[model samples]
Target: MGRKLQRIVEAAIIERIGPVTAQDLMAMSDDSWGLIRDQITDRRNGKDGLVARCLACECEVYIRTSKTRGIARPLFQHYNGSDPDCPWFQGRNIKPDAARAAQYQGKQESNFHRLMCELVGELAALDSRYIKHTVGQYRSPTENEHGRYPDTYVEWDDFGPFVVEFQMSGTFQTEISARCKHYEREGIPLLWILFGLDTATALPQSFIDVIRRHRGNAFVLDQAAVAASREQKTLVLSCYLRKPDGRLDAPKLVRFDALTVPRSKIPYHEDRIVGSRLAEIEKVRRPWFNALAQWEDRYKPLRDLARPQSLLLAAAFSIVAATNGKGRNYASEHSNISAMLNTYLSTKVLSPYSDLLKQIIENTRSSSIIKASVHDHLRRYRDAIQATNESPEWILLRKLLPEALDPVLREELAYLDALPDWANPTSE
Candidate 1:
């Protein structure tokens, strides 16, 4: 909002993270909306935090923090369109009235990071080779004139060593330079998660350029979309994308590979759906919901826990909505907790807490906890599906709308069709 902040966010984009061009960096962040939204539906009942991994270097780091705390770090969040270089990334400049929306986003992201941290922890706890962390900050330096703090220092493993500071967005020129100096002078392997949240706002490539300007071990984390650093690497794309025709042509596949070119590119873009898929989604909701409803009845009766009771009720409604009053499951049915979790895990968005889930199942005292968790997660799927009236699974389902009598029925009809017909709901 202020000139000082503008400059800092801009400078940090390029200084701390490299490979992103100045145009990209400048196009990144935008004006703040109102307060961010904080109400998160944490189906996982998991902790919140940030996860960073380097496949090239075979290193990983995880840190947890509250939503508000998470938002304060000045990374590239949704775009209010401070930079007009890109219009595709930004839906519209909604920040003027987005305080509430932003607040919700911040909170949701907090939950997201929390679960991610949990997954990372579970991963590291599983394998000693991985460096999982519960990053706790003892002291945070005062904000500079632009309200940016120096590279964050967290309380890590040893009493006084190996804590990480994530230069989230707008690369930190000073921080990177200082990091290089620190490396030369103190040899600290500063683990930086050069990340961005591209919604309406995408970070400018300039941010990474700034980071590169700094001479240090500050290897740039792969930006989303631009591919996974040649090959055999890890990347954090906002939401995975496929071809417009849903026909992964060879060149498109090659282009997709190119998107992951060197470690220096982040071409994160919104997913573009192709043809009659949306119509097909509406077509399938009925049967899919029917199966889901049947399963909920079967599963809820067996749940036998207070936590699960609430979840069961919510899921029942969702299934009812999808069944649309039913008949089939689809291949893309993701309206279940396990399904959604599978989606994220399969896509490499979040590491799976599969082991943790198994652990919860085994924990003698936490059976109710596990049951409730499973139920709650499934309920979230139902609720999201119902609220949007998108389709059977509401998530993957999509189609063109037909003329309808009223908004309510229209919504339900649309949603019913969204259910995938071949998910084989009986499997899990």
Candidate 2:
């Protein structure tokens, strides 16, 4: 048999508010349950406090906290007795899976979930285009073929239904794949909401896998934002996206009233705009780009090199190359390039001509090009400069070099300049 009925209860509660393991409850404060008290009550003196109303039977219920002897953590219990048909009512013959069929079956929803659901429904109702659409908890038919009950189902005017699943527990890859297939077969688009944590922390592998299945890198909803939305009586969702390199882009607050119903199954298309804005902001604020700009600003007078715009170009090229020409992998590539460039700047010999060659090497390495490939460019540039002293490209490159090593550095910068606009730092 499974562990015990208590284990199921603990799993149910943890599934509602997680990123915290069952063992971590000892560290949780009393206020962790503060948000859920209005729905759940303490069963003291057999009748002192108000009881939670069962979702299925409307019977009174009470929650047991960690203070209860023998109980591990907080769990809901029927005050009088649970209805026979209620999912939370644990019958002597009930199977483990049957007892835990639905995540919120026996328990009252946390305030966060209830408030968010209300706000989301209100926002959907406010849309003029979808004013006629119905938004509420989707109760799958008792004989439902798929056995799927989405947290919130939205019926659009012209588009298909959108199913929102609020994920608070660890999700397995197999489960995610199965759900994706099930929803696709049912002709419903699915949206996942990740609750309780900031994206700066490493996401659960299950959460990441689910997002991947949805063709998204991340789907986050900040609890604080949801609470604020409840207070403002407006729907505001804090969306945090994970880039390809595994860093979260800046969080974007999307107003529910401003959401547009897409022709496709997926409703929200704001991630692309949010990602583009983040990229624009990162162009100037990226650590590697900032480092390059600072280095150029300090050393540009040493040699008559191009302005800091060249460094920006180089930074962009590095990001593009690192992401396999996608140009959107700045988050991880920025750190990688910054480390490599810092090492080169600190250790390399500093003649103006050599510095330019070093910068090119830094760019190549940042792009993840093999050392042998870089050496080929180095050899070709040296050979061509030696063969033709008055080559136009070589003459132009020599102007950027120090007078001391005019002939020594040899048109390497010229070779770099001859490449496409993306490769040349000075080309913009």
Superposed Cα deviation of residue 196, candidate 1 (Å): 3.1
With a 3 Å backbone cut-off (N, CA, C), the pairs that clash in candidate 2 are none
* lDDT of each residue in 1-428, candidate 2, tens digit only: 55545422222221222222122333346566543443344433454443444433445445556555764555555455556455556444455565455544424344335544544555555444453333344446434575565666666565545666666555466666665556655667666676544454676777765544433434554444455455555545666555767666776776544554332233353444333433553453455444543453443521233433243235333534543444332222334554433433333211122334444444332334424443344333332223133543234433322121243322422311122233333332
Q: Give the clash count for each candidate.
A: 76, 0
Candidate topping lDDT: 2
How far residue 219's Cα lies from its native spot in candidate 1, in Å, is 6.1
For all predicted structures, in order, the TM-scores are 0.23, 0.37
Query: Model 1, range 168-199, lDDT digits (tens) per residue?
Result: 45445666555444432332333344444232
Report each candidate's C-alpha RMSD, comma-separated, in the order given.
Answer: 25.7, 14.6
